[model samples]
Target: MKKAELLRDALIAGNTWCRANPEAITVWVEKVGIETQATGEASFMYSYTIQALATDFPGDVDDLMLPLLGWVWEQQPDLLLNPDSNRKIEFEADIISDDTADFLFRVPVWERVIVTKTGGVVTAEHLSESAMRINSSEWETVFDPASEGNKA
Candidate 1:
């Protein structure tokens, strides 16, 4: 399928997922790579990550999700289960920039990263469900809205 079509389907899947999993905190998608075949047709791969809140959740990263949970506690950002609010939970790439980041502190977090192949093949892998405190500065950046006078 074409790139536009692929993107549309991915968005559709994300929306459907959001609908089915209301508790989902964030649905992040990014194009990871691209390859061209003999026909000159290029197929792009995308990566998606989603997180949520639930004690029953299978995996929790104390160092990452815990701080986010605190931000969510008072801010009550928009999530899968609660999207009616104007507030949004930002998904940032710089949250875990370095390897030692998590070793600094533990913050419970649960997230899943999924990859969509060119043909729409979906795959999920657990990147890190561990508590990471090294990215606290970035975390603050991610949740800056909570602290600023303005609320998004």
Candidate 2:
């Protein structure tokens, strides 16, 4: 999966919806760490930085982060569901000027390749799951509708 590109697109979509100017955002991604095994399994860590430039920056950081968080939720729901998970995403914000600000997010993205051979035939598969699960009580907590005049 193209995590960085998709994340950039998600942020752009969020900014367009909230600020109406997609051009003000620029995203850069770099790999900071990697782990690989002889068994053909590998994990990669990346830092994605988003730079927004405009004379008047509309909305707060939360507004910009909502979409990024949503994307992360889609990619790794376990990160949200299992608080004890060791892979913790980190983010930082730096205000460069009245017109420019930089937001840095460090996240782990991995690709695992599993290969099998039988009868002179070889098959390789990428072992990954992108799923979101919620239990009954958690579902109720998240999906319960708000009453009239009640803010979420």
Candidate 3:
């Protein structure tokens, strides 16, 4: 599947799952702007930052994130085989310098499932790890303050 198609499938699947299980799953999308420096006299550059959130699952956060990741992996197998390729199922974009864009889609499970103080049945550590992997792989620069200053 094409990169955009893969991302679309993941988003649809996540939304479907959330809709089907509203009591256990709460999914939402968040769009953020990313600024990058241009080589020339460009005033600004922007990219889409999409995150998925799944909450109140019966199992750990990894349990939810793994399935979402699996959907992404199944749709975009090239991402697993190619290190340099931008074939992620969660976020896909063709950004240009000095432009603004917004991506609307279902949020990932990592962002939602919070561990309660009672430690009911979910654990935050697992979710944190899975989120870390996704962040490091696809959303690496989302939290980087230095990258924001790169804009003109």
Best by TM-score: 2
- 1-152, model 2: which lDDT tens digit per residue? 35666666777765654246655655554554434565554333332333322223455666666666666656655656776853576776677667555666665555444567789897766555455566443432432233233221
| Tens-digit per-residue lDDT, 42-91, candidate 3 | 23322233344333333333434544555544433334435664344353
lDDT of each: 0.33, 0.54, 0.37
Candidate 2, lDDT over the whole model: 0.54
lDDT, residue 142, candidate 3: 32
Q: Which parts of model 3 have CA positions greater than 4 angstroms off?
A: 1-20, 23-47, 84-152
Q: Sorted on TM-score, highest at the top, how do the candidates line up?
A: 2, 3, 1
Residue lDDT tens for model 1, 57-89: 223244344444444432222232234532334
Estimated TM-score for each candidate: 0.19, 0.56, 0.29
Count backbone overlaps in model 1: 13
Q: Which ten residues in a row have the lowest lDDT in candidate 3?
A: 124-133
Arranged by lDDT with the best first, the candidates are 2, 3, 1
Number of colliding residue pairs in each model: 13, 0, 5
TM-score of 1: 0.19
**Candidate 2 backbone collisions, by pair:** none
